[model samples]
Target: MAHIMITGGSSGIGLQIARLLVQRGERVSLLARDPAKLEAAKHALQSQYPDSRPVHIQAVDVTDGAALHAAVMDCVASQGAIDTLIASAGMIVPGSFLDQTAGDFNSQIDTNLIGVANAIRAVYPSMIAAGRGTITIISSGAALLGIPGYTAYCASKYGLRGLATALRLEAKPKGVSVCICFPPDTDTPQFRQEIAQRGPETKRFLGPPKPWPVETVAKHIVKGMDAGKGEIFFGFDMMMLDKLGPIIRPILEKAYERRNKKHIGAQEGR
Candidate 1:
């Protein structure tokens, strides 16, 4: 059984991934900021896998590099050096660029981008010396293009793509592998919160297909990790965008232009 460490493992995709790994008899540890949530996740896992060892957990925010490193070491001492690291903790706030706060923008970068770096930095040396490991960064579809109300979120996730790209090159020769997943909107607490925060403008820009269930998203991510894929993308649309993002952006922009003009005409009763 491999020892897997997941940040943000108390809930959403992180927790679901842990469930899958545990079901397969892997040793798992969790890191998240909320003690109550972490404790609850631990109990839930233990209840499900009654025969397995207790999952180690730490209540620490990933944005704090030093604290996160210490938490990782604590898990390492308890379970073993983490053979797999999934950096899945992230947040998004939807609003027009002018309405987004400077603090919120900086927070997204720190938590999503720098936080990922910290998790990677904590485990990278050990993985390199051990000569084997996997690191999975959970980016988003927003990373590939500009979203109407996700300026900061897009920037942070895009940073993750770049982080994984460079790290993949450095890790391959050392027998460590890096994978980045671009999951489209997934139904989770975070997504619900995002929906609540979205303004009419934001909602107008987004419609149709609902978010994928968190279970499905987690399953795909785990399967990708199991297969050692360097990049994991769910859904045909996402795969298409990954292949044709640059080419497709212009088309989407024109559509957005037409949609905006129509909205303006309606507002003016023209």
Candidate 2:
């Protein structure tokens, strides 16, 4: 059993992954901003996997580099070396580019992009010194295409792709494997929050969000990690896009524009 640490593991896909890993006899550590949620998560995991190793929980905002580094060190000290580090912490604020404030954009960047980088940096030295480790980054389908209302989210996730690609090149030679997972709209607390603030054009274009369950997403991610795959695509459509994103982007953009125009026309008629 490996020692695994996951950021944002207090809930959603991150929590599910932690639970699954613990069930498989792995020692797991969870890091998030909320102490209450982290305690609750630990209780839930302990109840479900009574025979498993104790779950290590750390309350640290991913955006705070110093706090995050300290939290990571604590986990390593408690659980021994981290064999797997999953940088799953992220945030999203969707709106038209003009409507979204600069603060909103920067917040997403700090959490979704830079936060991941910081988490990686904290664990990287240990992994490199050990000469073996697995790093999984949770990018989104938004990384593939810039949707109508997810401009900032798209930018951050796209930046994650770049980070993973470059890191993979450097780490692969050193026995550290980097995997980036592109999960589509996932059924989580975060998704519910996004739904509450979704723009009409985005809602129409994406069509009544059918998010995949946390269990399903976690299953695929763990399987991919086991196989040591570099890129993990959750859905069939996502896989297709990963392969042909540039080729099909123009077509997708035209379709979205047509849909937006129709939605506007209907709104105007009303």
RMSD of each: 1.1, 1.1
Output candidate 2 Cα RMSD. Answer: 1.1
Candidate 1 Cα outliers beyond 4 Å, as residue runs: none
Q: 139, model 1: CA deviation in Å?
A: 0.6
Which candidate ranks first by lDDT, i.e. highest? 2
> How far is 178's C-alpha from truth in model 1 (Å)?
0.1
Q: How accurate is candidate 1 locally (lDDT)?
A: 0.91
Per-residue lDDT of 1 in model 1: 81
lDDT of each: 0.91, 0.93
lDDT of 1 by residue, 33-147 (tens): 9999999999999998998877999999999999999999899899988999999999887777899899998899999999999999999999999999999999998887787
lDDT of 2 by residue, 1-270 (tens): 799999999999999999889999999999999999999999999998899999999999999999999999999899999999999999989898999999998999999999999999999988999999999999999999888889899999999999999999999999899999999889999999989999887887788888999899999999999998999997678888888988888888888889878878988999
TM-score for each model: 0.98, 0.97
Residue pairs with colliding backbones in model 1 are none
> How many pairs of residues collide in each model?
0, 0
Error of 2 at 162 (Å): 0.5
